[model samples]
Target: MEFEEVLNNLKLEKENNLAQECLNEIQNRQVLFHSGFEQEKKELTSLYRLRLKTAMDLNRDKFEEDVLANWKKTIDELESCSAKKLKLNWVRTEFKQFMIFWNSETKKLEGIFYLYPKNTIKDQEEYNTGIINGGLTVGSKKYNKGTFIKEWK
Candidate 1:
């Protein structure tokens, strides 16, 4: 769907503005294809393509079946073009940030993107735990007497 159409639909949701921003960020990254995570497993573009080429080797059929179950529209888009993914907007609570992205391959748009210290509990004690020790926090959420209220962090 077009951005305007998606934005219009999101307008019905409580945090439509954030949802729009999340979508915009995702699309922009997809367009730019930037190295999203500096800490992500270092990879060469050729190797990444090779991995994707064979990524479905083991579970191609099962993967399609699952995606069909969770998001038929996404499947349709993939069939027409290639795989597409969509998910709920970003939400930030007190400590952690939550942002999930569904893939056209994965049938269900589910998973807590990441909650980690980049090291094990034991390793964290040994190491400084880079991921967890963070001061700059961004994003926001809303909750007010069973209603919604936006708060920046």
Candidate 2:
């Protein structure tokens, strides 16, 4: 499966499980205690929150590991071949795009990078078009918070 699809599935599973747990808790509370369950409810909520955060952290770590491993494999393959320039795009809960080029003189892969926010397709296309041509002119759009100028070193 694609990386993005895997992420989406993971998220959906988490949400569904959490929702079901919440519904069950509500039903149990209603059946067990009609008057004095406030403290217990608070404690349960706190525990659930902690568990939720831990689950999220684990998922994030797994996702990052998968992404890095895939990237290493791709880079290794490129190095073995005659590929010159490659553009890689990823949406890591947001949009990120970067380019790498094989530098014959330096005997290395060099990259120029730009990050873009997850936005409407029209906006994304317009912003990426500017980047591909050369560089984005200063103060071009409102979604400038996602733009980052960096190089792969």
Candidate 3:
């Protein structure tokens, strides 16, 4: 029974990983839309990115620390979230948004450093954890939750 349980858990983990990968692919595949709508979307995205960049560049240390703290606080609030079923998500901070998730398989808390230009609720921005640009450090590797801010500049 114990062996069976372990196998089931492993299967779930694999499924989760695959699902995440699929989502990443979708994010990378840019879509074409009506010229007007496309232009509007692009403008909004650019505006948000600019704001997020300015916030981070102004005082990188403060932005990083605050983002990390908010992510941790979010994790703390999720009663059901744990290493076994830990899921990473983007939580808002003063300047921007940061992602936090625990990869039980890797035994490391992963931080996705993305500068979300706007509030997630309005944008519904899909997870692009693969793209760690804009001076943010996002990757596939595991990270320590405690020292997340210092993980990247």
Candidate 4:
């Protein structure tokens, strides 16, 4: 079915708004692609693909507004094709910073909390204890460690 039709069917639920937002982002990205904004399009495409995993979270009613705002902010920044861009796959909170990615094998978006030590000695010491136990909490849900080790480390 067409994307619009899918949104139509979801009209009675909260998913409708989320689905519409996705469609709008998709359309915005496509317009950028056709306008010859290659770099911006590439970055936004990665985000768009990453966003597909949110549907499951939304259905479970565990989605967080802060994360959604984070995503929308990133999208707006990228869509503007501006030099001041937030780092991709990184989510920062007041207490911690997380690297997030979709784990293809598990079909889930996972986050890993990371702290960059102020000095080399501390960095080496902390590197030894990286990948903390109990996984990472994104929004209201906890996800297992992402399998993309190179990116996380």
TM-score of every candidate relative to the true structure: 0.24, 0.22, 0.21, 0.27
Please name the candidate that would achieve the greatest TM-score relative to the true structure: 4
Evaluate model 4: give its TM-score. Answer: 0.27
Candidate 4: which pairs clash?
A: none
Candidate 3 segments exceeding 4 Å error? 1-39, 65-153
lDDT, candidate 3, 1-153, per-residue tens: 121222233334444543243233223322111101111323433444465566557756555565544433433433333333333433333234333343435433332343434434223222333244454544321122212221111
Per residue, candidate 4 scores C-alpha lDDT tens digits across 1-153 of 222332233232344343334334333321110111112344544655366356335532543555555555544434454332222233222222333222223322222222222344334324434543235321211111211122221
Q: Residue by residue across 1-153, what tens digits does model 2's lDDT show?
A: 222222233243344442233223322321111111112323433443464355446645533444444344444444454434332222221233222222333323322222233465355545556775675432222122223332211
- Model 4 lDDT on a 0 to 1 scale: 0.32
List the global CA lDDT of all models: 0.32, 0.32, 0.34, 0.32
lDDT per residue (tens digit) for residues 1-153 in model 1:
223333344344444343444344333321111112211112322333353345356545544443333233322332343224333333332222333333324323222222212333234222322333464433322332223333223
The residue-level lDDT of candidate 4 at 40 comes to: 35
Candidate number of the best lDDT: 3
Error of 4 at 17 (Å): 27
**Deviation in angstroms for 139 in model 1?**
9.0
Model 2 regions more than 4 Å off? 1-63, 84-153
- Model 1, position 43: C-alpha lDDT score: 30
